[model samples]
Target: MILNSSLLVSIEKHFCGNELLNGEMYMEGIKHYLIDMDGVILQGTKLIPGAAEFIQRLRTKGASFLILTNNSRYILRDLQVRLHDLGLEVPQEAIFTSALATAQFLHTQRPGGKAYVLGEAGLTTALHDIGYILTDQKPEYVVLGETTTYSFERITRAIRFVMAGARFITTNPDVTGPGEGGIVPATGAVAALISAATGAKPYFIGKPNPLMMRTALRTLDAHSEDSVIIGDRMDTDIVSGIESGLQTILVLTGVTTREQVERFPYRPTWIHKSVADIEVEG
Candidate 1:
């Protein structure tokens, strides 16, 4: 279902205001695609239309890709199961998470370090897998991640640890996330509270940081000039990709709408309706 080059140009002219793009990805096609999860492929536990097809297209072209998600609540296996139940066959290894990135960064900085964790199994297990000890007894770091079960007891403990000279780190800086009822405070919100109490700012490890993108890109052995990042958020996904020197595609199927694009000072290399509108040829 690849659209003709002329049709692609027309869409770009209307949305991008340029018939030709200004990146290495123009006409050459993408070698690797760093795709977002919640908004691009899935929407509230359901697979978006054309998600599976887009994945299949990539596989058929022998392209490299990764499912990059900022949600540190679930591990790779958990994500695979969720996507599997939703009719997508994404492999566990193909998923890159903020928890994993944070763990990797910490491991590289201080091997076998200890931390006071505030998150779910995803974050805990990532630290565990890296051979890092998790404890609240005057640890070396105070790591915060996405957790639905936020308790005042834990928040106070995190603040105390940070105040006691433990370095503060967070998974991402997203202040809000979609909850069952509506928008609810996420890791960023909780991190702010801890920061306010301890007078300590946290080092964020996820999108818009560019470190996460570089790590993920290195994992795939993909070069930035020939890669593309597709996402729904203008703040995290698009900015991260642009900063990391990769072409960015802002898809409308997720959190960001077409109108919201004008608000951001930066623009993605391309804007498509969805993954369905993007096709690659080898």
Candidate 2:
């Protein structure tokens, strides 16, 4: 009703709920959702008890969601195959990874810089798609992600380049990521080892940095208040969601245990055992 500053202050003393200080109103609604892949959706080789059914219900309700993961070992297609095999419907476009986020950051930071990659085809493909010139010969940057083919030689080369003043960047800072067998060293651990040797810390561009979350949000075109992020890791997923101004829901079906949540610095808005326990009120 076009209330002025003075009137707004006056109304605030008595206004609440559906009415704001200026007679404006706001209500939280769920429009888009971002979910963590490994723990929240599926754990190891099995889908979480109710994750698939929950997603189906969300789809039927016309809510859009993207499966966001900090695991950069697999590309979008790889993840899609895994999800499909689990009987969950997930499109490649609905998958976002730290590899993609790192590539995007590099594209903006140094468009044509030559990068030395220390990861699998996922990170390489992501960099190539973003128009970066990847090379091992006198690279201008050392891009690190999770790699199963890690070796002392690759580490030595990356350190050499970084020591020679090449920019260093990592997809995420997760020391160990959840795997089919158990926790395994992620890109963060590898990045740290390199940084320790070269004394050059890599800029992290994945979860908890807000870059990946923002990119996912842009892809969905979802308003901050109208969205929620569900994940298992408090350090990456939950923290990133909170930082990006989205409601955070921590599911106990993944890495972070129930007791761990209380000790976490950033507390989620809600906690559940799995998607099965959640009721999408929006």
Candidate 3:
């Protein structure tokens, strides 16, 4: 559905209001919400203030939403446990990760394909679940994903595979991500290293790519016009939302700050100080 100018204006006015909510403000047009996980919900293992409450509010109102993440380190169960440990209740079905998105994309591209994977349980499990064979033996694709410690030997093997004509695929384009000890090299950084070595670039299948957002919307049975994307990054989340034809909400609690946002050519539909400032109730 196309979001007309009047509807966009109404959304802007609703966010600008100081009140928590007016009657049916959220239920009026927005039925689905796509939320980012890392900086928007939690920074590393620490929960951002009001993150749990915001999710609870969605659950309480029976609203449709999904916690989307580009991190391909852990599987859905791991993420669900982590959120539970942080006092947030998110079902596995309500969470979507880049690992899952990549796997889905690959499954559609090449069914039962062989891959040489450099990732953790998340990436491996997703591919395995989709009937992909994880091997270094003339793999159809050399899949790069996030890992705590990237192995030089494995990267060497990946380069060799790419040189041998295997396709290259990476989970996301995030060079660094927040970890327990500040920032760490993510999938994109590792993919860059491999690309530099092999002179072959991997197809990134995560945020900033509208494919990821489109798949998430399909999973949620949501339409862009009635859905909202809440994220902390302008490059990935906001751009992807815009490309996917969804209203975007930029939160200052993540990688992109207000000043950084100003540098971007386009703007989000709304900007909030944090998730705490957003009222999902109506």
Candidate 4:
């Protein structure tokens, strides 16, 4: 049965136990998904309700997907371990990190190049796998990524390298990340400090930078018209998906709220409580 716009809001419907939700939501004809990991899937270290179910729904419908994250601290294996510890099972190839995108970007620009890095296993491993050498001796680029331990000594070296004409690059533009107590300094925060000292701005290669989105789509072998992105933050995930020509779904389970969406000029195609509320038609 067809319903008018007024009736869609006044009456609720359900199919196969999934509620037909509101808020510009539409999942029909979506053959692929690009989902944000931190907010849309798991908040902190715990799995968000319905996250696994959503993945299962995608798999059941023979859809392709990739879990996207801006955090560059851990490699794919590390992320797999963390997700497994949280009672969630995700394939290693199904996860994509900003570090990987950064490495890919550098590989294309200057293959087999040297770089001075300030990150954990994730960033360094990605750079290494891309045939890029990690060095501090007159490197071509000074790469920055998220690290649990922020060292003044390493940051100082990065600043000096940038001052010496080494191009600056960062994994993501997030200034802060979720910590036990509150928000903590991230790659963007340190990038800001380095910029202040050297007067050189670094290129960001994560969400909100359609570059990463396009790279991910290529990895999935999927087209934007047939893909959908589910994220919580409007500035990064939503904006990047919109700019990349993919459908965007904003979940309220993370930073952005229902009322806060009105503040942005651009709007997500859909807004829901969480991934669980989303209906993926089979």
TM-score each candidate.
0.91, 0.86, 0.89, 0.91
Report the lDDT tens digits of candidate 3 across residue range 1-282. 898885666455434431444322243677789999988998767899999888888888778999999989899999999999988888999999999999999999999999999999999999999999999788999998889989889889999999999999999999987767577888888888988988998899999998999999999998887888999989899888877778778898978988897798766777788888778744
* Clashes in predicted model 2: 0
Q: Model 3 segments beyond 4 Å from truth? A: 1-27
lDDT of all the models against the reference?
Answer: 0.88, 0.80, 0.87, 0.88
**TM match of model 1 to true structure:** 0.91
In every candidate, how many clashes are there?
0, 0, 0, 0
lDDT per residue, candidate 2, 1-282, as tens digits? 686764453233222321332322221477788988888998788999999888887878788888887777787888899999989987798888989888878878888779999888889999999888889888988888887778999889999999998989888888886666777877888888988888888889888898888888888888766788899888888877767777677899888987997696556776778888766644
lDDT of 3 at 175: 93
Alpha carbon RMSD to native, model 4: 7.1
- Scored by Cα lDDT, where does model 3 land? 0.87
Cα deviation of 259, candidate 4, in Å = 0.2
- Minimum summed lDDT over a 10-residue window in model 1 is located at 10-19
Candidate 2 least-lDDT 10 residues: 18-27
lDDT of 1 by residue, 1-282 (tens): 897765555344334632355422352656998999989998887899999999999999999999999999998999999999999998898999999999999999999999999999999999999999999788999999999999999999999999999999999999999999899999999999998998999999999899999999988999887788899999999888877777788899888998999898878888888888787878
RMSD of 1: 6.6
Q: Candidate 1: which pairs clash?
A: none
Candidate 2 residues lying further than 4 Å off, grouped into runs, are 1-28, 178-182
As a whole number from 0 to 100, the lDDT of residue 246 in candidate 4 is 77
**What lDDT would candidate 1 get against the real structure?**
0.88
CA displacement after TM-score superposition, residue 107 of candidate 3 (Å): 0.8
Q: What is the TM-score of candidate 3?
A: 0.89
